[model samples]
Target: MPILQPIGRTLLIFFAAAGRLSMFAANGLSHCVRPPLYFRLIARQMIDIGYYSLPVVGLTAIFTGMVLALQSYTGFARFAAESAIPNVVVISITRELGPVLAGLMVAGRVGAAMAAEIGTMRVTEQIDALDTLATNPFKYLVAPRLIAGITTLPILVFIADIIGVFGGYVVSIYKLGFNPTTYLKNTVDFVQTEDVVSGLVKAAVFGFLITLMGCYHGYNSKGGAQGVGAATTNAVVSASILILCCNYFITEMFFAR
Candidate 1:
């Protein structure tokens, strides 16, 4: 009975947390559709989530693509299947690596920032002050971030796909001694619109999860500065984990035969 108690308690806590998150998400998304929309705040969040994140996302994508190309060449060469390198690189990047890498990078950067900022506001009573001021904090803070995340991540992933594919092209042509024209043709011929679209969809979902986890953790934070730090860490870790988990489910939905 004692051992069963611990398992039961853990399950209870998990379900409670899940319920709270679902409610938080529903409230935030409901506010997103309501009136008094803050375009300015949304725009600011867009720049923060998208433009400011470009350098890290781009660099990660390029390096991932390059390493993937090199690794694929090494593996495929052993089987005299080196000609398939471009196809693999293009398909892998457009379908998985670009979105996943970009989402993880942004989760580390933007998710932590959102949690820290909001958790500070929570600890300092700023969020309560907004309530006194007749301003809905969810609309003003969470909605903008959520909207920006959903709208911007697809664009980020799209640009990442291009840069990633280009990186593969450079590595395959220069380091792997592959002909540029053949590699380009193979890449173009192999990639389908569904692959790119599926990746963008995953990016949008990941963006939403990142911002939502950050906001939820921060908004519910306690214990002052220490809580803020914990929330920030939780935001990044939870968002990254969710991105990976959701990526698999989304991929299954899109491509599983």
Candidate 2:
């Protein structure tokens, strides 16, 4: 009976949390679609989430491309199949690595910031004050973030894709002594429109999930400062996990036979 009690408690808690998250997502999404959007706030968030994040995302993408090229070379060299490096690099970057890595990086940076800022507001009673002042917190805060996230992530991922592929190009030509013209040709020839589209779609989804998790945690925080801290941590962890899980499912949807 004691063991069963623990299992049942855990299951109940999981379901309760899931329900709350789904409701929050629905409410926030509704606000996003309805009128009275704060476009200035949305643009501000887009700059914060996308422009300020470029350095970290760019560095991560470039280094990832470099490493991927090196590793792909080492593996393909095993069978004298070195000619396949460009194809592998381009397809892999456009389809998987660029968006996933960019998502995770932004999730860590932007997600934590959102949780901390909003959680602080919650603990400080600013959200309630907004309600008292005839303002909708969801419309003012959550919607702007959700809109910015969904719109900006695709652009960020697109830039990351270019930088990553260029990184691979640099390595293949400079370090691996491959002909630049041939490498670019193979990359262009092998990659398809669907691959890029799939990645952008994944980026948009990831952006939404990241902002949603951050806002949900922040909006529901309690216990004062410690609560805000916990919310920030949860926001980043949840966003990152969702990014990886969604990455798998999206890749399967796009590429699986």
Can you write out model 1's per-residue Cα lDDT over 80-185, one digit (the tens) per residue? 9999988898899989999999999999999999999999999999999999999999999899999999999999999999999999999998998989999999
lDDT of the structure predicted as candidate 2: 0.95
Judge candidate 1 against the unseen true structure and give its global Cα lDDT, from 0 to 1: 0.95
- In candidate 1, which residue pairs get closer than 3 Å at backbone N, Cα or C atoms, i.e. clash? none
Candidate 2: list runs displaced more than 4 Å: none
Q: How accurate locally is residue 139 in candidate 1, as Cα lDDT from 0 to 100?
A: 97
Tell me the whole-model lDDT of each prediction, alpha carbons only: 0.95, 0.95
lDDT of 2 by residue, 133-199 (tens): 9999999999999999999999999999999999999999999999999999999999999999999
Worst 10 residues of 2 by lDDT: 87-96
